[model samples]
Target chain A: MTYCVGMVLDRGIVLMSDTRTNSGVDNISVFRKMFHWAVPGERIISVMTAGNLATTQSVISRLEERSKTPEERSNSLLELPTMFQVAVETGKLLRETVQDTQSENGEQGKGRFTASMIVAGQIKGMEPRLFMIYPEGNFIEASFDTPFFQIGETKYGRPILIRGYDRNMSFEDAVKLLMVSFDSTLKANLSVGLPLDMMVIERDKYEPAHEQRIEATDEYFLSVSSGWSDALRTAFHSLPNFSFGQPGNG
Target chain B: MTYCVGMVLDRGIVLMSDTRTNSGVDNISVFRKMFHWAVPGERIISVMTAGNLATTQSVISRLEERSKTPEERSNSLLELPTMFQVAVETGKLLRETVQDTQSENGEQGKGRFTASMIVAGQIKGMEPRLFMIYPEGNFIEASFDTPFFQIGETKYGRPILIRGYDRNMSFEDAVKLLMVSFDSTLKANLSVGLPLDMMVIERDKYEPAHEQRIEATDEYFLSVSSGWSDALRTAFHSLPNFSFGQPGNG
Candidate 1:
């Protein structure tokens, strides 16, 4: 399992994904799940994938190859006219990748070779957009009702995002929010681990305004991890003790 | 879907379960998920279930009836020799219930007619025991390293339990901690919801020392719910913002 999140803020898009992948608990591996393409000052697109590694990698490879040789596929990420088109192309590749793998593996593996992705970024004049692409090639763009998209082991980290996300928050705060969300997931689940990949695409920049890979030893991340735990404990203690009509109760 | 947690603390055992049960997002109903029986000074057993309502209800009804009249089906919970035996009996009953339902529904229903449960309580001389019963009739008891069990929609509430649980904490604190955990689950998942059922069985007592059903308007629960949102927001702000070597940041 994987955990990746992409948020559309007033400033830009902030995306974060863990690098852990595993066939089973014992056979763990680290693989980058975040991919990006930017034509300086023209358009920027970022994709974070979760699901069968083979399917995601094949889709990414196809995306990369098609962009370099647009005449072959024509749906090149670099040539996409808008973020919507980019999402459509990415979703199409993901669906084709899953179907191709499944057809080889036969009936039992039909749904096994599938993936989900979060696509985010902007074109020079268009507003930043965020979308969650499904294994079936369909997608939903984030809006005021849902300003963020998360794929993979999303539940463990969602309550924090539901509570902390603010459209007007700064990019730094957005990244910080994602950190806490990811940290909650990491601490609760074994599949999502450290060495997180993060990208901040400032509105209209067409390039990563700030990018960093947070490792287990990253000081700021460590503080956020340990500090959030402490803060939670403090917060837990601050809640009024439950009173079931006990003698010391209200 | 459901969210029910059973925890073992030094002073006693605490169990909490949401009352929401849904066949789909639009078809939701309230149903009690917590059941307990007390022999006053002999033994006290509590069961919290998550899964097919038919299977769980069947298992509980059989347990209840068999205990009242032990001649028909012999592994009656009340007549069990120890807490372990009670758990074994419950597991056997659960497995039989699932198998019976599945056989009637045929092949496509193989895994659907299943349920998981947390069984907790104590017998007069033995220590309190907690077991998580699976649909397969196999079960595992909670131990020092794993002092709690949560079934159905468990992920969202697990981190708080992992961080805040202490075997030595008071029943009030334990209930408080569970309220926060349930609150998190309720906020994140619609299937696990309001009007929580909670019961605490103190050491050596065969009856519930405290039992309460917290409704949507319960003041203490309201405070815990809204207060936790504020507390979490505060905690999120308290954590250090990410520093990607920004000149004014690091």
Candidate 2:
């Protein structure tokens, strides 16, 4: 399992991904799930993947390798005219990757080799956009009513995003909200681990505004975790007492 | 779908369930998911159901009808020697109900009529106990590590319980925690709706301590919805600002 979230705010786009993969409770490993590509000052694109590591690796490898071979990379992610087109190209690539792998293995019921991605960024002059790519290689863009998209182990972390997200929010606020969302997922799921990959793209900057790998012992995250627990405990105590009704009131 | 939670605490047990059923977003209706029985001073038991409504109703109807029969009510829930036995009987009833329904339909797939339950209560001589009954007629009791069990749309509401729940928490505190959990679920899932049913069983007391139905407009719940949104916003802003490697010579 994995948890990755992206918010498209007025200030820019904020993306965060956890780095944990597990075959079972006893077999757990850390693997970075966030990937980025930027033609410095031209275009900056970021994607975070979840579901079937092998499938995601194949899709990403294809994308990266295309960057080196001009002929093989035509109509690829980097050359797309707009973010929407980029998503379309990436979705096509994902579909091709899955079909090729299954045919080579000849596995009858591999159950779709599930994989999805959160793709967000800007093209030279286009607006920053956010999209959630589905396992079927189709995608949906974030709109005014939904300015953020999440993939993988999403339910556990959805409440924070629903209540705290603001389209007009500053990039810093967006990152903070993402941390809280990721924190919830990390605590509830053992398959989602630490040392998160976080990146921020300032509007029209065409380059990453900030990027960092958050380790388990990072001071900010430690404070966020402990502080949230304390806040919740305090809030729990402050709620009004149950009336329980009078003996005759039932 | 529904959202029901049961907690076993040192003070006693807290059981809460939402009354919402939906076949899809378009076809939704209100249907209580909680049932209770009280042999006034002898025993008090509350069962909350989730999953197939037809199966749960059949299981509860059978249990209810048996309690009224003189000769056939021997291993009935009310006559059970301990709370654990009561749970086992409920699980067996649920499994039997599913089996009968499946055979009637002549289906060869996994029984779609299966249901899960959270049973919590007290018998005269024993302490309060809580059990989560699976569709397979098997059950497990709540322990210190996991003092509460939730059924139905559980994920959205899980974080509050994980962070605020304490085995020794006051009965009032536990109810509030349950409400928050329910609030989270209600906000995130349309399949789980209003008019929640809640019952409290006090330690060693064989009758329900408190029972009430919360309407959609209940003031407390309204406050919880808005107050929680405000709290999230405040928490988001309170997180430390990220300067992200500002060339500070550190």
Query: Who wins the lDDT comparison?
Result: 1
| CAPRI tier of model 1 | medium
Which ten residues in a row are the worst by lDDT in model 2 chain B?
A: B241-250
What's the i-RMS of each model? 3.2, 3.4
Candidate number of the best TM-score: 1
Q: Can you list each candidate's DockQ? A: 0.60, 0.46
Per residue, candidate 2 scores C-alpha lDDT tens digits across A1-250 of 8989888888888899999888778888888899888878889999899988988987887777744676655435677788898788778878777777667767773656678998998988678889998877899999899888888899999988898887887776677778888888889888888989889988888888888888887887777787888766666555555545533224
**TM-score of each candidate structure, all chains considered together:** 0.95, 0.92
Candidate 2 lDDT (Cα, 0 to 1):
0.82
In the predicted model 1, the residue pairs found to clash are none
* DockQ of candidate 1 against the true complex: 0.60
TM accuracy, model 1: 0.95
Report the TM-score of candidate 2, chain B only. Answer: 0.91
